[model samples]
Target: MSSADSSSSGFVLLGVEDVEDCALSNEGEGSLPLDRFGYVSDLVKKGNHAFRQSRLDMFEQAINYYTRANQIKPNDPIILGNRCATYLRISQFLKLRDSSDSEDRPLSGLDPTIHAELALKDAEKLGEIQSNTVRPFILKASALLLLEKYELARSTVISGLQVDPFSNSLQGALQHLEKMQAGNNGRRSHTKPERTDDFDCTLCLKLLYEPITTPCGHSFCRSCLFQSMDRGNKCPLCRTVLFISPRMSAVSVTLNSIIQKNFPEEYAERKAEHDGLTNFGADLMPLFVMDVVIPCQKYHLHIFEPRYRLMVRRIMEGSRRMGMVGIDPTTGSFAEFACEVEITECEPLPDGRFLIEVEGRRRFRIIRSRDQDGYRVAEVEWVRDLQLPDGSQERVDLLESTNNIAKHASSWLTRARQASQQDRSRYEKLLGLERMMPTPRDPERFSFWLATLTNRTPREKLDLLQLTNTRERISRALIYMRSGELGCRLDLNTITNAPPYTI
Candidate 1:
């Protein structure tokens, strides 16, 4: 709320003297003729006084006053902040009182954890309004520690430490939490306790975050299980052969919950650490397991392989995009030059395969590629032809050369397609090319089109695919067309490994 709005609300501005005067005025007068704002402020003051006296009833009264004030001027962050602070105090004071007693006691329907979370949320709102301070974080981390969430407590304190590194209070809290953690560790070290059949993953040596039971009935952490299986599909503990994959894990929810409830701290820490590892290099693109395609061209794909099917789903979930680089069939790895493709249409089959229609968006060069889970993923930099201003002598000469090469390449393709016209060569049966395809509008596109039509080995076509220069590609296509040395050719009846048609 704006200051003008708040000032015009007719609520009395509270001060220490006003509170003292309120107490005196009530003692003598039957009742004070106070406005709504004054009434709320009085109640808040009473709540503060009650807190000094360590009375729970007064804290509840303060909450009621703020709630009522909130209904009148709902956008006031001050009221919310006051209420949040009140809640934190109440929770802290109650815990201190309970801790002093020798006997354990249960408080019904008044879980301090819930109130602390509320205070943390209100503090977050206050931070949005002004600046985040150390008090709210301290309150929250203390509450979490009281609730036995040691790892969360440590993390919360660490965040506050980042914001205010010189905060002695935050530093002290961290030290205290570390001491508690150290005490626990020291006791665990002193005692060689008997195992309670804890299902800690042998790989991580921590309680399973998402336990996945193997075919052999032994359970492991889902990620640990997947990574182990990726190395080799065998049960890590039993050495039993297993068929497992990432993105698809059969999780044991009951076991997972059991571990979470028992080892909340370890689970929280492990999950945070594992999440960091998994999200590393998240800015990279998913590698589409297919042949090279030129930018701005339409391409169709039939996703049948299990690994590729998973990749399609992942890319579709994101920007509906993925990078395509041809496998150098010789090296069994993708080529350096790549094209990014976007899914235009997708039809899922009953047996889990998909027929997808993809369009080439633009060109990108692979900076690096690596196996993630079962499929390849890459970090790439976009490729763009060097900018040459129109009407420049160099540009005009280049355009003229590109046009001449395009005509020659077209004529060569027309003649080479004669074998298909005579029905001797089934080029039509190969890439659905009954005759020479129409030339693309741009010279760069025309070069790729001719290259795809050219009968070349997969590696040879990839060489044409890797050419980043529009002029260079046109020049290469012209040489192949004029010399008739390894020109574009297709075998319609038999499948061939080359550019254009991707399986």
Candidate 2:
């Protein structure tokens, strides 16, 4: 089998799409009795053949062949590497596949997450067997990236670089990690010094934004250094090979502060330029693509990724708002509808993560979307329920429906609280729901508030966000509340993943 770079440039698989060549000989296996080694070779050849096909089912077949080969030659680097690559490839395919398709014809065996976890195991074993080769580091790092363990992925790449300083793949992976930290926005500088070319980045010749001072005692804009490294893994000015990765290279705080204090006007201009990229316009907002949130929903989020950290910092400086969205599996993109949320509280942790409380305010439909730096940005149109005429029959009916649901919800809460007294988590959920109860006078907000009392899938919540009829929305909420009450009688875990109820 020929080993080359795969999609992420880390796996030691054959070709990107197909098997171009195979070296394992099966000449005598058909005609003669084969030994253990001969049989192992034959299995690997078959695995390679299947892997080269690049179809979802074929990838699974390749994994099966590799698994059999591994049984014959346990911990073999070749077998382990090939299998790891295959697992990652299949997981990627499944993740991008339409959700409806998977639901319609579900895989009978392992899911995407399981496949990625299995790949990580194989990568770890391969690393132990081939400690001196760059391939092990590549495979392990690739698996970690697929698993969304950003810090671990960076560490793996940094370690791989220690083994092979000139490895392009490792360097590329490190650069990718840095971009994940945030966009091109740089830190503010302080100090009093005569402004000159010294504050300028050699690459952009502009005032330094997020400046980094390399070990070689050279300073350059963080984005400039990484962009230069993209073409060649070396210092732009010097021929020195830099060892600094995202974890290792941090912005020069003192220098950054000096620049900010000395040139206030220029700094403000630069800030505006950067903000223009992250925050598009009055109707445009930066998007956090993770979960489905609805108006009146309040929750806490752990923001660790660099890009989001940067996005949060920018929001804190301005309107303190952003959009929360979930990917639509059918389109493999942002769902059409999302909720705008305001950051009610933001506590920046010592480790650069944010513990923030956000409350959903308004629902919006994405008119268009685009990639801004490493995250997503979009222009959206706000959504609101169509109001019923005052004193009309429909309005009166909605009020009656709301009151009935509210009474039912209250009775359910009382029982749930009594049952959950022995279970702190469930009790806490009930308490949260009680605190979020809205008066029946506002049937529209009341409907969304009612839905938060139960745990529903993102798809289900997205459906709620798209509803413009208060009565219909309240009816659906009543159904879910009733269902949860039933589920709780048998098992308490059916309550929202947390204490139940928050849109």
Candidate 3:
């Protein structure tokens, strides 16, 4: 209810522990509707006072009280805002209190900026995005500035200026941030690079971002730990029972400080990882270009190639995901368009080969490529259909065209089935088409599914897969069907004789 209570679960009713963790009255009771909205508001006011008390202990007390008020009226903007503010203060307090550890140097995965970012996120949830609000922008810029994301911070400030051009507070904050960035950039220093692998979280197996250290002293990415916490409140490494809520728990400040002090390079990577945007796909993945595949569809693969075998093992170890592409006949490279696929089923053989099944998740446009362990991998941006808004003229027209084309497509597939009824090889493909034909509601997905089931040459498959726009893809398929090109391509021999692929 606290707009950004990261621990908040969706749809699942809270158990007594969750409810108790959220809402407790002064008398240590469940509170259970006994606290009026007005009383909850007063608690928020007290929490704000506690935050301003200039005491670290008081700052945590502020978060506790604010959190309780939030449990009562989850949507109360004031309480949510104050709670986020309290978290930020608590973060600062912890940093100051343990600034210099004489001992092993406190290592933590705690991310303080998350509090500021979540503050703005919650503010936006209260319809603050449309309002001429200075607080949200300040909080947003604060988080970005802390992460050394000056460009984004400047842009966020500019957006705030657009809302309230005359706010001196915002204008002053912007100037101060710019000066700080200039000073930091101008500062010169040379140092030995630090190893990122040392701080890598075992879960994602990626460099840690917003790291957390549990009671058992195992550190992990905050998000990764939360995912595991969702299944059970225990550390994935040592089976140590966690005594804290993932959402309410802050990243370990001591561990982070230690990492920052000892390994500045790794610290930078951690910040960069947190700031990373997965535009069209999951981070980046290996491109499986042996064949063509479509989003929302699944494929069975036999991994015999050493490179692919390595790719599969890496995928399983990391995200269990990869991008599926086809060799471009024109350019002799991986096709520009590709589908992001996730390994759903993996079975290892006595030999080194693996029999695996993958389901496509998203479409992406490859931005850059590199060879890793004898396989092709790339960074990609997520690509989606050029969808028109609901009830709009273009939207209506596209749907109309899609529905009409679906009818035509249905008829063609039906005819192919009837004609090939005697031919088991061809009919096998057509028999499955009619029963599982995706509706035209998602023209892009429907078109891709249609293309996948068709026994077309790899060249034709790439052509369909390359079309990104939903309406354009649908139109192109419609043209293929109308011109009888699809009919010719759906031949039994053509289906059986095409190159057998593993990906």
Candidate 4:
């Protein structure tokens, strides 16, 4: 209630001081002391006095006193109701305060929305404590109205009407809610303005999606802004240096809402367009140009570049999968063969970097590739080793070779573990690779797993990916394993100043 309404019937404050004192005196006759009643009454009276004063700070002081009184007399309906009203009054005052008049004198405290929310909480508690009273509903309706929840306010008023059919306060609140709804409907019914560039992002020349306004007063789509920032830390239009990153930036909520409410169809199309790039399709995949990863191999990646950071966010939102590839030393472009990896864990840091764990799933050949935003996207065809005919002599021979390779791999790991005692990193890698050993029955998978036993250059790994014959790949891995075993033995023999051991 406003100070102007203090003399009118619209303003009301219940006087419960005498009733509280009388009840406390009755309790005193049982076990309570008279001094306790005096202290509680003093607090309630102080709250009422401060609430009546025409100042914002006085409202806070009133809430403070009411809170103290409530602590002494828990669940007091009178205290809760008064505090709810005070919260509502202070919130309304802050929202309606004249900005021009306060240019020289700034007000500092809780924002209007927070105060309204607090009032709503207290009003809800009061309703539970005194369900049969009309006052709780009235307080609740008023708070909801202040918070711009007109439908809930109307429902609260109707519930109050059911309790007291002739309540003037509830009838007035219900009418106010109806009028607000009609006004909103009428405004929305008006003819929309012609399409213009005002709602379009300058960077992409399209309707803005998740629009972000730079400090220099220019707006662009969030992805477009950061993608351009990848080239330089400056605004595209103004060329002004911007120290802001996507992690530190926020969307322009008001502008985005306005565009959504005004041109919903265009906004939806813009969202679909953005989603298409992020969640491209089943046959298409985004490529992370990094290293040669084969199936069953797992590793972690630290993403810090602006483009990859943006890519990681999109991947996490969609399939959590991407193609990991290496640059071809011959063509200076992405290798023709790449492996698909799925992100198992992604942790986004406060500084906008991502620490992600990805595991290689299968291989794919890039049929065609292009750039989207700042990263590579490709139309790929899944690659698998050509299988030998079932029950054929070639298949039988392949199985025998795979089993022999597996035995050799086991013996090599045991010897490497004994030799790598002083090298903690190498020992840990060996142990991890050992745990992931595949079965010899699936020769294709076993070949890839076996290739991991020895460190190969990117070119050698790329050659492994290009091979389609399982027996040839298995033989290639056996060569690497034997060479690695021989190198370990040679190192030991040299360290001991003895003859080299045979593998």
Candidate 5:
């Protein structure tokens, strides 16, 4: 059968009317008033309709209805269970949108993460009341997954599966986990067995970053493969012919859903902050300033292509400031919002190429776009000041730690430069020092830094960029960085075929 047909066949829909019937049947017990049952049914319909229309306000209204329904039929499994599902869905949609728009500004205001956490707590309480219900368990598992508590998601799903062995959804989730585990294992097993030296690349380790895998399945950092590829499109180890196009591996959707469910509070907060930043300029017009958007957190961008070269020249001639809007690789469309970037460094290369560095300043959203002399121009509105959550000092501390780590790394680089006695330009020296400096006012910078230090995949980094609050972003970043550091260090022996030592 086709995928659509299979999907339609796999799950049964339980409508508001069915829910009402169930509640009405229980009304004969005199436990709930008949009017309350009708009210709940109406509320459920409204909530479902609002969800279908993507009306956030309506979802809130539905919540009120469900809340009242609970009062009328206290401890009713169906009421509690369905409400949990609705809340989870609302939370997920909000988070997805927030992440998509996060790069625009520093987030402030309400704590989405805390709200999500509360919602999950409610779900968990309902799950305990109705221990046999699979829906609550699934919702809880999903919430944990959103929080990046993978082990918890895994165990929860397993427990649910034990209760209902033939649940296709549970089975599908398990399979996805297995695939991730296998992929991770394959990477570990393919490394050279006898190199036996710490700090050596597992695939030529030399401090792995911007890792890319060859068609023959060998992986190497971008810098390592750049020169090698200049010679030929073949794997250095296996001589397998390579495909030049870059391909992103598909992430596990089920896993992502779990993360969303588990860590609603963090996810929501980050998303809101990201939206504020990215959508800052969405309402303004007549954008006279040029803009540049860079996705790579490190390295100077070399603009050589005819189209971009012309674009940059026009910006330099027109205005030193430009709008840098990130483009979604999958969609090839500019993100809903962009950031104002100041050109800090620029140089002309020998081959008519230009090397440049731009610093992020404020977030904006594009109101409209126009083609100008073979380049793109966008009108935008600037975002207002972002406000932080109460007790966000801890988040500030995490950012400080990241800055400190970068400073230490810069010091090491400085010593290396001094020892080598290589003559360096003033600009190069400045750039080197700046690499270790964090963007003090930019929360997105913290998120980017966390993604870098944690060795998170590009997709994961993108998710970070989408968050809305500085505190939540920093919190998530710290967690990812610490966990990644530990994971990378723990597997160092296996990765490099060497004995372990303290960093």
Candidate 6:
């Protein structure tokens, strides 16, 4: 017998649509091989059931069904991918429960780390299969992210995007990287400088932090001097030619003693970390001296505003730390997430305004912001990193769908490239068309596909920000790509109204 005929006896072929309603009416009635039809039908029904259960938040039941489906079709990529997604959901639920437990209470026997590791392994294995390979890559990236290997996770995502530029999951990964990088850079630039009361620099508005005493007995922040030198080598206060070395004078013994006495906790923490006295603690600390009152995300942001600027200046002058809070997009108000900043660079503008850079090292959530000593003071709570959901089959399906879209998109790109080579002027007329052409593992192209494919409406594009899961994002993008409504427009109006700029 032929291979197809031989295989027919071992497995069932069920219509994808019929499995959704859980009707097994055709199980024994058909002339086809009993084992094959029964198995495939049963597997499909289980998948449908799992999907329904997941939507209802009956995650445990969903996981069981997904597990069974995988057993029936052990090598099936879609089934494997879906199972991984279910596993991820279970992990998330367990972690949430653990977080709610009281510190005084004894821990449960279950270990979240073990579960996460197992799920990650399964994801990696499933990623190896040719039919469902992309699923593994996406899941592996997510697993790496949960494990706190940010750089590795970012690289994995970039690699996946290279294979499938239209993947929403890869796009999400790229965005996550950008946000993390931004937060890291922001934190490094915002370190607070030392304070001196002998001479107050008019530029930064306090007794000079990182005081560089000039020949004329004036002192300014080191950063302020460097910036001033770029325009004119004159002091803002006296317009004297300010000549100074790069190094700042050492912290006076008396001021250091006073800080050690007044802020014992802060002083000790800084000293231990800086002196390498503590092997386990982080190297840097947050900006402000505020007590934490709530839990927040990994990082907090402080926008450049007027009142907060003065608050930062005062904190740098004495404590060398200042509080930060993220602004809500809806109300333009502060969120619970906050951090402490250290002013590293404080520059004086010719107009007496200060240009400063601060670094954020730790995260906190704000309980309240109160006005103190003409500056805003926040009560915050320190937060630790939260665990992500485990691997799931839905995640696998999303990855598979993304790969399907990528295959189609790449084919389109190939065609476009061929067309471009044939007629350059014709290609030029199609604005946004060139973007569809493939690049050498470009992150920008991945982002472009994500925006073009999944976001049918402006509102939908805005909603993409809310989805945390990479797989879900990719699935949404696939739906858009199949709709056949993308990359069809070239806004000639903008092209016609352009300035004299030419390519």
> Could you tell me the lDDT of residue 390 within candidate 5?
40
**Could you tell me the TM-score of candidate 1?**
0.37
Better of 1 and 5 by TM-score: 1
Please give each candidate's TM-score.
0.37, 0.49, 0.40, 0.52, 0.32, 0.29
Would you list the rank order by TM-score, best first? 4, 2, 3, 1, 5, 6
lDDT of 5 by residue, 1-503 (tens): 11111111121111111122243235344353343356556655665555455454555555555655554455566666655555554444444443324234312111223234435665688678767756656667655644435567678778877778887666666665566557656654332322223222354444333345554556554334543543455667687655441111112333333334444564466456433322333343223233233232433467665545555544443344566655555666766565666554444332335566665555566777887434466777665334655458855664565566455445644554455445434323433333434564444554444334435543444454455565555555455544454564232223342212111
- For TM-score, candidate 2 versus 5, the one ahead is 2
Q: Which regions of candidate 3 fall more than 4 Å away from where they truly are?
A: 1-281, 296-298, 411-428, 431-436, 482-503
* Cα lDDT of model 2 by residue, 1-503, tens digit: 23233344222322123332344333432221244457567778888989988787788688777866664455667778888888777766654554355334543223344456667777888788788988778777766765556678889889988999988777776776776544323542233689899998888888988788875677887656644553444678886765433213446756776888788898888777766754557899889988999887877899877678667766765678999999887788789999999886554442345677788888999999888656788899989999889999988877886787688788877777787767855655565566567888889999899888877778788989999988767767766776665664323335435333322
Candidate no. 5 TM-score = 0.32
Q: Report the error of model 2 at residue 172, Å.
A: 54
Tens digit of lDDT per residue, candidate 3, span 18-122? 111233233433232232444565677777677777565576577667655554455454565555555544444333333344123332323333344444455
Task: State the lDDT at 89 in candidate 1.
Answer: 56
| Tens-digit lDDT string for candidate 1 (1-503) | 11111122111111111112132232232222243346445555655565455456666666666554444334354565676666665555443443223123323224343345455555666556445676556555644554446688788789888889997666766776676678656644333333354667788787676787764778777656545543454678888654333223335545665566666777799888765443434347778766777654556788866567656655543467887778777677677777777775454432345667676766777888788757887888877666577789877776676666555555654555555555632432322231223344355665665555444455655666666687666555444443355544434335332322110
- RMSD per candidate (Å) reads 22.6, 20.2, 17.1, 18.8, 25.8, 26.2
- Location of the lowest summed lDDT over 10 successive residues in candidate 1: 9-18
Better of 4 and 5 by TM-score: 4
**lDDT of prediction 3:** 0.59
Q: Tens digits of per-residue lDDT for model 6 on 330-436?
A: 55665455555555334322222345545443445566666643345555665543223335664454445555556666675456545665564443322223323
Candidate 5 local lDDT, residue 370: 83
Candidate 6 stretches greater than 4 Å from native: 1-37, 55-57, 96-98, 101-107, 131-133, 185-503
C-alpha displacement of 398 in model 3, angstroms?
Answer: 1.7
- How well does candidate 6 match the true structure in TM-score terms? 0.29
Better of 5 and 6 by lDDT: 5
Model 4 spans > 4 angstroms off:
1-196, 214-218, 232-243, 252-258, 298-313, 327-334, 344-358, 389-422, 439-441, 488-503
> Superposing every Cα of model 2 onto the true structure, what RMSD results?
20.2
**What TM-score quantifies how close candidate 2 is to the native fold?**
0.49
C-alpha positional error of residue 464 in candidate 6 after TM-score superposition, expressed in Å: 60
Where does the lowest 10-residue lDDT sum fall in candidate 4?
13-22
Please, what's the RMSD in Å of model 4? Answer: 18.8
